[model samples]
Target: MATMSSICAPMISVLPRRPMIVAAFQQYCSRRTFRRTLQVRSCSSATSHVAPLRRLANYHPNIWTDEHVQSLTSTSKVQREEERERINVLKEQTRNLIREKQQVAEQLQLIDHLQQLGVAYHFKDEIADVLSRLHASLDHVRWELKDDLHATALLFRLLRAKGFSVSQDLFETFRDEKGNFEARCENPIRGLLSLYEASYYEKEGESVLKEAMDFATEQLKALMEEGSVPEAGGLREQVAHALQIPLNWRLERVHHRWFIEACSGDNTIDPLLLEFAKHDFNLVQDMYKSELKELSKWWSELGLSEKLPFFRDRLFENYLWAVGFTYEPDNWRCRLNETKAICFITLIDDIYDVYGTLDELQIFTDVVNRWDLTAMDKLPEYMRLCFFALFNFVHDEGYRVMKEKGLDIVPDLKRTWGDLWTADFEEAKWFHHDQTPKLEEYLENAWVSISGPTILVNAYCMGKDLTGEALKSFPSYYQITRFSSRLFRLIDDMGTSTDELERGDVAKCIQCYMHEKGVSEEVARSEIRELIKKHWRALNASLSWDSPFQEYFKNIVVNVPRTAYFFYQDGDGYGKPDGETKSQIISIVFEPIQI
Candidate 1:
């Protein structure tokens, strides 16, 4: 929304408000609770059995059935060769969509469309060439800054999203002498939408971009509710969608499929681009189907859902999480590997949190920490199958990572698993003892319990060259991953805490805040939301670290949290995908655009 052109000696003078208290409060909590918490934690480490475990039915049985597995495994879906050839032709046509001499605004809009279509990866060089030239000669660009709010905002959002250092000065052109945005203009609603999208890339301390967000959100929300125009209904839908998830937060494939439908019936949209988008989308869907065929077959063979009735059967959701981790076709192995890893994490988490009793949990934890099948005798009959499943999976993964990749990250991977178990065990201990930790105290361990770092370690190992240096140099990656884990914990707490509390879990961050500050649920939730944003900035800042690995490698870590936010933003979208997330999964992975 904002761009740089010239300096504003005293540009919009910003009124300074009270500094945010959340960050300060978090630091204060951490400091104040440090010594006492350690003392409490020391006592907590010594276990004392209090009461017999209740047969808790806190969660419902998983909806999956053997028949469901049978049907998924039996399905033989394949895209015909004819479709591949057709898509190749359409890709060529789409390539022609980005030519050398297009107007700068048009080029930016085209790039934006291609990106949202999930086919931008196919045209990276073409898009990059256009943006590079445009960036080098912005002054000589053909588009005038005065008349085109939509184009300006779109260009700003796209370029800034691509890591360009565009400034906020150009946005000032839309403001009056009193430094207020002009809300009345041609296509003001669409302009405001793009401006809102652009504001997400605001770096820390950029008050202008922050102000732009408040301005655009205020304008868009008012416009949506007022029903001011003949096409107010369409405007309402567009506004609602934009305000619900900022463009940066959206998964590319998910947004792409949605856009394919949104652009339908719009005469101005390029026919070639639209056709190519459909072809590419379904083509990728075919790839996902093919991959899932193998994964589903493997999952069906495990018979996990039938054996471990308590564990949620989410074969599809696990794979979907991997897709979020890395969606490029060449990264299928990483996706598959990460999918299996997360599957175990999810099930094991369920075991510690819900199903397994205190004695059973300690035995299983020790068995897992040792990765020893000999200890399986100590587990309950049901847990033996679960333990063996993970044992065999880890051994197989270890062999692949070592023999296939010629690097021994097995130990590191197991260490991540160890960290996860320690965290999970700690929480299980607190839960069993009916302990309510201080906000800082719970957060210290809860982030790990979220298991993002463990899942991401598998992702990193799968996707990267497993060098000795890379294996040992994991702390930096783990640091970035901690940010993700914290976000996932916060989001999970936001979505599932009430149910969790009812089921006799330890106090989540929100509950701890409510207890500590004596605040209402609403206020506690608002504070948690602010804290989530704080970690979001931390995640963004982590990407700027001097990493031994490439930026893409780091991005996979960052995307861990991005995908979590996408998954858990509204509710426990991953665990309960009945509403927005369900539709999104259908659009991205199953339904094809009707070309």
Candidate 2:
């Protein structure tokens, strides 16, 4: 042992290089004997006059020269130092590899677990659980590793790709760590579905999508405890209680599809019909103010003086009726206008053609013609609505076409017309009968043709003029009207027989009409088809009348097939529906008319 604190400590000390040599000398031989016995030791001792070995038998040198000792000491220190350094390097390398392997293993485990979960993780319930687990893990990591970015993001991708269950706030709070989010979303199945789903939600997931949803029940509970969340106050329950709405496939699908089809084709239904339907269907909530303003401006610019006088009031009434007819049932304007139009049309049609004598008609006509709107004070209350409608609608461009068709060719035609119009109530009623044997039957048949493919054209105009909540889509209207018309026509046509019609059957006119159209005898009725084509042309022209109902009317005429009119049953005198007929009609016709 050595005390190196000594100031006089030897600068260099040498010891035997070999452990075996040093041990052998110490155990076996004395230094004097060893020196005398060894040839080199003997020679060196003689020359140096080797100090007489003290106690030769037990002689032991305090100082000795041995190259091995010095070499051994130097090698031992160097070897120990090298060994220490190697052990340290190995431990450091192993620790680093362990960390790397742990990360890879964790990711693999996650992937395998997710694969087992399958795509169900992308939906709601399962997705929420996955997100909860993921968020919990993150929370642990945030505490354990102080929010490692690479670690957190991989978990985020897993959660997002599978489905989101976390609040947008939580997701956004970690967005800085989500470097290149779009680039990370490379999974094809995940990408397609995610994009489609995102289209229904907000573009920026930060506020609504990610932050809005709670990641965990605990998190939700926390918010409630803090009073940060608002109460819904049973609003949804109230809404459900107030309404028992049913689904209408016709309104939702068939009518919309058919309307678009008709509008796209080379038919009289105005092309704008589909546009109108779309506006009412989708944009009504947002675009109401602008639409009303434009409609009013158009009305003010066009006055009643430009329209044909005879059909002028009728056109105006129709316009007002349109405004009322196309809005939701709860709308005040709609209700008001509906009441006014219904009474006005019912009374005016009767007064003009059926209800009044020629003298009365003349006086009424003179009253409307000679005076301004103020003079309507002398007429019945219903007349006021009629006069206003006429005054306003005549100002529309629709009447110009009828005038140009040489309809007003005769001079002093009113004077001649008053005489001609005298006492024709019976004839007019007969003409009405000639047109349709029964009122219900007539309305049903007309409604079918009007609603089917025809609504698309008319929807455009209706959408343009109406305001407030969208009552019903043009497509829905067409569907309802078509189904109604077809159901009635089918029952009416099938009930009648050719034999019955030949027997001077005035009762089952539906059958008579079918026979007149030669529907039964001929497999493919060419003449009937030609008549339909002509009717369609007329209907198209009628729809183009440039009135407010122009678009609505156009669709009615265009979408409905003429053949559908023949669907009614034909009976000898009058027809009745079969037992199953009502149910079948209700199922097919009425089921699809919901909003």
Candidate 3:
């Protein structure tokens, strides 16, 4: 295990020495006269006398400026050292508590808190050992939890979430002969909430869990309507939040502060545990600020926002999205590189959807497929700059891998970019032709167009546990990647399709479904929501299979969709960040937990 200092030290040493070409680009961007002239020239190619009529989305300017981001700083040295020492002490103490004997309910509750508090990564071995022991003593554990819906559901969820083969039939103990959950199970509210959350882990054909979900959902909503729950602590608030989005579906880091504050108010939790969680969260947040500062400088220096001003300038949101994928402290490199990939994805997505003419898009796609520097001459000035940035990013990553692991991943990286551009070009063709594709036809391309595979491929390369075997086995993870990408596309379409359609973009999944089925928009949206749920089940099921991918890589793959839900659950959170998205970014990235 690397210390936080060691994990962060590389950034300080490596970021300042950028390649000379990037510095020249930055110098060009710094010149206002040259930038304006280049922007005008790039909008209209030399081959055409007329400037193409571009469809601009008119995205909102980013609220987090480079000055603000760079101004963010960490705590004093004395305070940092104290917190580190205190965290180390609490970590060992927490491990001892996990090892201590307790009731099944108590032990499961502790594990749940550790996970929600975002400190469970420190005790994975201990948690696994405890779960293994509990799994082996099923008869006794069942006897103890047979009457306790909360414990039974928690055990079922935690087990299933960790890839244990626990049966959903365990929930059958709470149901009556009429196939309805008994009224007695509804009093505790916690039990109903637990059951509600646990049902989200259900795979296909699990009718019992589905029934449990529906019943618990109805009961919880009724309770909320009647205002019958006690408001003493955060239980009522937690119940309300869970009703909006189940715990299983949430990105933990996005909601970490809420959970931490909720736990702070709970009298049943240990003081030491709560204290440790606060310090740990703040410490990690400090690391995030450092990474953001470096990334802000890098993005500012790259000059994309200034050079190509039509696209969305969402560096802050991109970093937030990367954090959603993997928030552990040691994986800062993954977060940084993933943010870069997301930025390019956003940039290229806009080029194809909003700016590029059909002919230019075809040429761009062909150039990407060629994956050669010689092809750079065919693109417009703006596109040439974009391609050069992407080319540098891919090879830089490839060079790092080659230097570290003696593996050349440039071909794999280029292939992902090629697939993404190809998909984008297909969509551009559809929009250009005023074509509404069949739902199936649209989805076949929309998944790749969503950029999940590109992001996951880059994540696998930057992440630890990479191997020659894993590189060869990359194609075999298609089921996981496809499921995740399909979910991202469906969820994104559900949230952003209206805005996208109104702005003269291609028809998204919802519109395709409506056109194909001849249904109302409401019906189309509801059906798309069902599709999201279906793919989620498939994604969960894929994780349970024996795959050649490492568990870390699998988590990153699944988290792609999870992060999408975070951004798009309300509506185009990434595109329009003034609402909940802004608040979440302020809370998770900027604001530290009060100690």
Candidate 4:
């Protein structure tokens, strides 16, 4: 039997050509006469006589303090019990409703509502049964929905979303002899909205869905411009919201409260279903508060905020990220461990990006790669503390997994940590040497540097059961990881590159593209947006691929980019959270829905 270490050694070697390219770039950079202008003071003892010049981001203090987070309380135990009982009853009623709905359209709408309200996990089996039946009888479904554009689009979206093999050819029924979506499909706002949302589920090379997207978008915008959409029932608001960010891309937990509020204004919504959604949301929110309180205590005790004051203290944001990845009450362990990993990633990211001199960063990277206590003495005091904090967290997690599942994942954890630091160190070298690689070269390293692999790998270790076979099959999963990380890096660059450049960081993907193509910044941004869409299509296609990973881990992979899109949609939401991010956090984490 192959050892886990031997089976997983290749996971750390993403983009093997990257090192040679980086070396050549460094060789070229070292020969440039202009290098002296870019060099900064080193933080080594040899330069102890000179005060080291450090770049400070001056990030705002955390809006949600540890004291406030620790002070949070949920409902009393008795009330929580009562609510749980009521929710169970509601679940039964919802189940019966699913069973009773003989019509395919009704079943699809019910499942869509349940998902939108963020309570679909309760009825996964029921929803799957319906989709399976509908998928099994595609001919009957096609006949039933032939004239009904709205139901057909809803069916296609829901079925495809569940990884069912639904064909885009089903949409041809609505097209005319010219192979264009008929004008009759335009006036029905409900059908148009459904088509628009469903179009986002398109895989690459699907020209029909692309046309449908363009048609629906044009009609929807035209109707809005003509003031034709009804102002009542929140339909207008729904259109605007979908236009801003489609349902397929938005984070589920973050969209839950908004959808619940939207349903309240919708007269067509069932009173019982709406009640169930509210209670479920509050109960889930209660669970999150408890988790946050405990995590807050953990963060407070970790004392990294005081020890490394230069980094952003973003415990609340990190918790939001964990919840975005996995919001089920049963998966609290995954959420907690994920938050801890992200906190350390953020702290270490700051060390490379903002504070650490190149020499100090290289030393820290070497220490992390060695994964040894003896190597810690070479790092600065601050780097030593950060290294130990990461070391203990990773080993502690590895210990838990080993004790529970008889799998020692310490080597896996250490490899991902080393990979992340190596990528970060490469970027630091780029910054210090004033070299701008092409966009492809930048992303080959930036994707890993973005910390998506590290976060996802930790998630896999803590959330999934490990076996020798699973470890053997792990290399295949890295493709999805790369896709997720690529999207994450691009979205992050779009949001933070301006500030990063001002603070003397390496050239991000956007800047790399502009330099490579000799295009304007506006053109570069537009191109990056196109790349985001392209990667999303690739990711959507990858979800249906057969792999050793269960849907639980796969969903986390997809949600990584979805969460990034949410935070960076407006502007550096995680780094500067005082704007819309603050209100969003309050709604999702703190404020309970009024039942």
Candidate 5:
């Protein structure tokens, strides 16, 4: 705890701040304001006293039709097997390419293309070998490759990603006599973008990298204004993309989709890697299609879409999110498990928030806490089905965990459900009473309500190779989960608060801060943004060897917060992803890139 505070505290002061286009959603939902958006289904505001619910469309029904789910396609069994064989062939071909001892820049650029095109995950050992060799030569390359921004920037990125202790001093060569970035006015976009992207990997106290961020960001923004210039259109596009989401913060799958499309016109990209990337992506997309179909079928069977009339039925968004968390085709089973669990969580969240009355909410919470069928009889009509659904899902999950990990997961599952409901009940209490707790008070419950801990704990249950010892070591109390959960809450509240406030609900960080400080919303948001960075800094610090969790689990935990950024960045993409989120879904799962 002391280490966490110390790590977060210093880094909170590390960097200064900088600054959604969800139009398709607005057009589809057709609500003038998102506050009244999902007024669908009978699952309107549950406060009871908030009479005459906001005049809006029925906010919740299965938006996708049977045809939609049926139409989602994967190649046939023989085709996928063939595809796998082709992938192995391409994998070896790419391996030979990475194995070749070409010029230093040539090899680095090949590695870069492999990574940017998203095929790099297939070449991890080879990539690691190359980077390890390069790192050993770093001191020598320092003097030789100094002032070569493009190569140096790529090296920093590759080394840092491979876990090498890269120095920020690699960028010092780009500074002028005044210790300012050289500004490469004649032509600096590529170097600037590379440096800008690398700056994101700097650890705390690296003020030089922070300055590079400022320099690169400013330059990128100015260049982005030039808009598709003949010489720099691609550069402008790349800069704009980097400026939007730093390389570290970028969601891995989404980055590949964007990078592949961006590279289409560039002649310098290696054709083999690009071609392999498209096939690999399409092959993966086939897996995603199969998984989504399974989830869609499970959702259809659960009958929550029909029984729980007003709850948000976001199956597509739920699976899309699960993809961000675990996208490798090898983990399709885990992805499906995660998708189903989150769908349950999302359904239960809405049931607690928008459907159940305050009295019904309390009873449902108690029933879930009890974790028994006998308790189901205590529930009201609407609550009965939800309680039954949740119990069945968790019991099945417990069985799965016991079968695989030899762990009695029921206790942990009960704990997560109990905690999630307690958090839900607290928010309902606050909303009904119109009380805005102190920001800290609100955030304490908000993080739990955001439900990262519960779902991640569930993830621990469903994940492979998690033994009881690892389970005890995890215990849902780790700093990584706590920090990322907090980030998820803060980000969610910032994006969804306006609508939530309109509907009359719990006070979020933004509202709590505004109420506590009597500040403007914009100012509160800016400060909240800074607090998010502090949390990410803490989250990052928690991932070192000092942490008890395994490295693979650590990587998964990191994506918890990144998932929030992706869905919430453009106006509740999870809730109404028809706009920008729609485009992302198409690129990630539906559409195949033409080689």
Candidate 6:
């Protein structure tokens, strides 16, 4: 007990400052009362030590030092005020950034409105003046100031729409410091050009469009070599280059007759075959010339003469598709005339039986059956050696492939010749005029009746295991037809034969399905996007197919999968209506595997 009293003596004993100390203790107790409400573990831990003190002191509240409390309160107020000022500064900065963005958005909306007005009222002199001013203002904007390349490209397009050629000027002005401008604009100008070129080259000769292609290619290469540009933009260069050159150009350049003519030696005329060659060349040339005349007529019929330049390319593409295989029965004269002496009659039957007029068909058939290769001089201006060369190529190649497969081909050839002649002669009564179908209807029929199914089948054969039932059921003739059809169809679709829709006509099957499901275009488009992505995923997930045919399929499917943005028009023309948003619907067709 004595030892315990000694231990407590320091804590309890009175001293000179005993009253002051006691007052301090009472004040500390009052502070503890307020702090105890906090429920801190430390407060609970200290409660045990304070129990005896409460019993002993029973102290009254004592005033705290004015100096200490005033100093602490003033210091806290200063700190809080400083914090508030800091918050206000941050908020002001955010507000400024938002204002900047909104201003930019407003500017974009204004630009779009101005463009719509320009296109709608282009012919009106007053509106033209307004459009001109807008163009001047927009043209004055430095390319480096554009935060988005897509936006800049669109602006350039708008300027072009306002009747100014911005292609060369756009490159000169906006070649540097684009920042995210490239990201935003997406190089829409180049894209438009590429699509246009790709669509155009399908029908027209490459040489005819080479100048324009070179210009576009140069612009694309500049974007790529700029190095500072994003890889995304740079990646488009190859596509631009590819679109510039159609497969026909590559094929024909290396092996086709047009290329052979261009590269022919010394322009030396072969006396024996010169007239024949010139005659055949003229026939082929005349055919193309006739196609161009037909195109002009088609344009006039549609009242699309003003839009002709826009479709001038696609029209040429249609020509390419039409004429690609049309005159294959004859080609440019070759040096080895003897080796090229095979008869030309592969496509004559198809033209007479399927595509030609009765009178024209009769003329063709009679020429085929009765005409003599030895009597080249007696033939018309169109039936000379050039035609002979092309004919020889078809017959010779056909004979070789057939003979290698162990078939008696001579009698088959003679029978085909007779069939062509018979059809051509008999159809003369029906050859009143060339049949012309509605452009869209003709293309749709072509897709369903020939190209679409054929290409799809080709894609299947390239990927699927073609053993057992598939191998047996698929005939040699069907295989040949399907293969030739795909090649022709691809060429045709690529803008050579016909102008296939850019985004692909989903056919009623797809549109009806979407409508029946009661889904909005937005939802349907989303689903399509997901479906396409899923297809690509599955395609990538599979073992990489390495064969030549597989590679070909991959190229078509991955690189040039058909879409139909070109020929489709709603109530509004090609694009969206005023202040209305539109989404694209993409449907993918796949073959189901059988168990």
Best by TM-score: 4
- lDDT per residue, candidate 4, 1-595, as tens digits? 1121222212222221222233323443343323334353343533676656676889989888878887787899999999999999999999999889888888888899899988899987778778888999999899988888888999999988877788889899999889888533333888899999999988899999999999999999999999998877788988988999999889889888898997587875788899999999999998889889899999999898988899999998999999889887867888999999999999989999888888788788878888879988888899999999888998888898888888888888888888888888887777776567778878888888898888888888776555766765656677788889899999999998766665656678876776677666778899999999999888877777434345677888888988998899877999998887888888988898998
Better of 4 and 6 by TM-score: 4
Name the lDDT value of residue 464 in candidate 2. 34
Total clashes for model 1: 2
Local accuracy of candidate 5 as per-residue lDDT tens digits, 145-167:
66577778888877775556777
Residues 1-595, candidate 1, lDDT per residue (tens digit)? 0110011011222123223356533443343354235335444553553433333434544444445534432113354476778888988877876875377667777888788767787876787678767767765552465566777787777666555556776577777898888744467777788788887766666677778989999887777678652353345555687889887666656667777777665554677788878877777777787777778788878888777777667777777778877777777888888888888898888888776666677887778778888878897788899878877887788898778768876776776787777678777776655455667777777877888767777777776555677666666565667777788788788987766655545568986776567666779999999888778656655555333344446657756766776777776776676667667666666666677
lDDT of 6 by residue, 1-595 (tens): 0111121112111112222223323343344343334224333545665311111111111122223222321124464465446545543443343235333323433343222211111123433443355456654564443544434444443444333433333433333453111222444554434333332221123232233335555655565566533334323433444454432123221122322232233122222222223233333343334334444354334332132121111232223322322222222111011111111221232333233333334454455555456655544333343235444644664465344544333333333334334533332222222122222322223322333222333233322232333323333233233223333323332331111111111122122223334444345445544433333323222223434333333333322122211212122111221211111100000111110
Cα lDDT of model 3 by residue, 1-595, tens digit: 0111121111111112223233322332234243234435655653577776566789888888999998887898899999999999999999888878488988998998898888998987788888878888877898788888988888988888777788888877787788889534334798988899899988988898888889989999999999987776678988998999988778779777888887577765778788889999999989999999999999999999999998999988999889999999878889999999999999999999888877788898888889777988888899999999999999998998899989878888888888888788878776655566778778878888898888888888887668888888777777788888888889888889767765667778876666666666777789888988888888767766334247678777777878888989888999999889889888887888888
Which ten contiguous residues of candidate 6 have the minimum total lDDT? 584-593
lDDT of 5: 0.71
Model 2, poorest ten-residue lDDT window? 1-10
Q: Ten residues in a row with the worst lDDT in model 1?
A: 1-10
lDDT of 2 by residue, 1-595 (tens): 0110121111222222222223322222233233224434434554696732211111111121122112221124464465446535543443343234345325423342222212111223433444455556765544442233233334543444333443323234333453312212322222222222221222232433332222222333444457544324322221222122111101222223233333244232322333333323222222222233334344334332123122222222222223323423223233233323333333343444323333334455656545367777765544455566645543331243234332221212122222222222322332323322232343232232222212222233223343222222333344333333343333333343233223221223332233233333332233333333333323322221323333333323332332222222223221123333333322222232122
lDDT of each: 0.69, 0.31, 0.81, 0.82, 0.71, 0.31
TM-score (C-alpha, index-matched) for candidate 3: 0.90
Question: What TM-score, over all chains together, does every model reach?
Answer: 0.83, 0.23, 0.90, 0.92, 0.85, 0.23
Candidate 6 clash figure, as a count: 43
Candidate 6 segments whose C-alpha is farther than 4 A from its true place: 1-360, 366-406, 409-434, 438-595
TM-score-superior candidate, 2 or 5: 5
